[model samples]
Target: MRMKDPIPQFTDIITKASKLNLAYLHLLESRVMGAEDCEEGERLDFAYALWNGPLLVAGGYKPANAQRLVDTEYPEKDIVVMFGRHFISNPDLVYRIKEGIELGAYHRETFYTSSAVGYVDYPFSPKYLASEFV
Candidate 1:
C-alpha cells in the first residue's frame, strides 16, 4: 500500500494547517495503533518539527509512560497525552493511575467480538468501587 504522500505535498498540507491558527493539533502517531502495535521506532518527527503549538497526541498510552512522555519527550511544547484502549477497560482509569492501582487487563481476542462481553463486562477496581460507596 502506498501510505506516504510526497514530502512536498505533505509539507504543503502541514504548512496550511500551521497557518490556520488552530487551537491545537491532534496527532495520531503511528506508534501504537489500536490493539495492534506499529513499527518499533516510528516517531512523528515531521509533525512534531512542524506543529509548534499545543498537541493532543493519541495512541496506546499507559499511565506512567504517558506522564514520562510529556515530561521528557517534549517539555517545551504544551502536550496532552490521550488514552484509548486503557480507558475502555478502566472506567476509573484516572483514579487508578493516581493511586497506583493495577489496571484492568484488555483482552484483544474479545475486542469487537461481543456486544456486552468486550464492551461493558470489564469490572471496575474493587477499591475504587468501595471508595465510591464510602
Candidate 2:
C-alpha cells in the first residue's frame, strides 16, 4: 500500500515491562507534537526505545492517558509487545518465566550501528566465568 506521508502508519504500539513506563511518555509527546499534524487515518505511533548498555540505559514505554483513551477512543485496541535487545540474549525469556539469572551488562562503546562493539563483544556471564578460571 502507498503511504501518503513520509512517516509510517501504525495502529498499535507494543511495549514490554521495561518499556511500559517510557512508551506512554513518548506517545504523549507524539500526540502533542505530531498528532495535530497527522491526517484522519493517521494515528501517532509510539514505542519505548531500548538499550542493553549500562544499567541506566534501560527504558520503558509509558502511553499517555492510555486508560483514558480506552475509556474515550479505543477500548478494543491493545498495544502488543515488540521487545528489542532484551530478547536477543534472553531468547528463552518466555519459557524461563521466573528464572532469576543475572543478565550481562552491555558496553556503551558499541551501542550504535557502527562495528560490533556492544553488539557481540559484551560477553555474557559465562564468558566471565571461563576467563576467571583461566
Candidate 3:
C-alpha cells in the first residue's frame, strides 16, 4: 500500500498557527499578477487578502510595481513584497531597492543549471557597497 502525502497535515498545522496569530502567511508564484493578463477581479482578490492580516507577497515583484500596489491599493494593510528572479541577478536586492539602483537582468539560460553559474555568481551592486566604505 502507498502512503498518503503529508501536505494536508502541514497545511492544517499552518492554518492552526495562523488562527492563533502566531505566524504570518506568505504567498508566492512564478509570475506577476498582471503579467499573465489575469482578470481585474482576480488581482483585486489578491490585493484584498492583505487587509485580512499580515502577509508577505513574493514572486515577480519589481520595485516600482510593488510600490505602486502598496501606495494605491493596500495602503492600510500590512504587506511585505519580495523578489525571486531579480534576486538571482541581484544579490544586493534589498539594498538596491532601498537605494533606487537599477536591478540586473537574470540569465534565463543558467536559471536551472546544476552548477553555481546562475545561482551564487550574481555580483552585488558596487556603487551601493562603495557608499558604505565612505
For this target, which candidate reaches the highest TM-score against the unseen true structure?
A: 1
Ranking by TM-score: 1, 3, 2
Writing each residue's lDDT as its tens digit, candidate 1 over 1-134 gives 12565456666778899999999988765555555765443456677778889989876677777787788877887889887767888888888998999888776677777467767778889898889643
TM-score of each: 0.78, 0.28, 0.67
Candidate 2 residues 1-134, lDDT tens each?
A: 23565232332223233455443322322212232322123234332223111111112212223334434454444433232344444444333223344444334334466775556554444434454333
**Candidate 2 or 1, higher lDDT:** 1
RMSD of each: 3.0, 14.3, 7.0
List model 3 lDDT by residue over 7-115, tens digit each. 4554565556566764566765335343342212113333344236777777567898789777887898777887778888898888889889999878777867789
Between candidates 1 and 2, the one scoring higher on TM-score is: 1
Instruction: Estimate the TM-score for candidate 1.
Output: 0.78
For candidate 2, the per-residue lDDT at 125 reads: 47
Best-to-worst order by lDDT is: 1, 3, 2
- In TM-score terms, candidate 3 sits at 0.67
Question: What is the C-alpha local distance difference test score of candidate 1?
Answer: 0.75
Pairs with steric clashes in candidate 3: none
For model 2, state the Cα shift of residue 57 in Å: 16
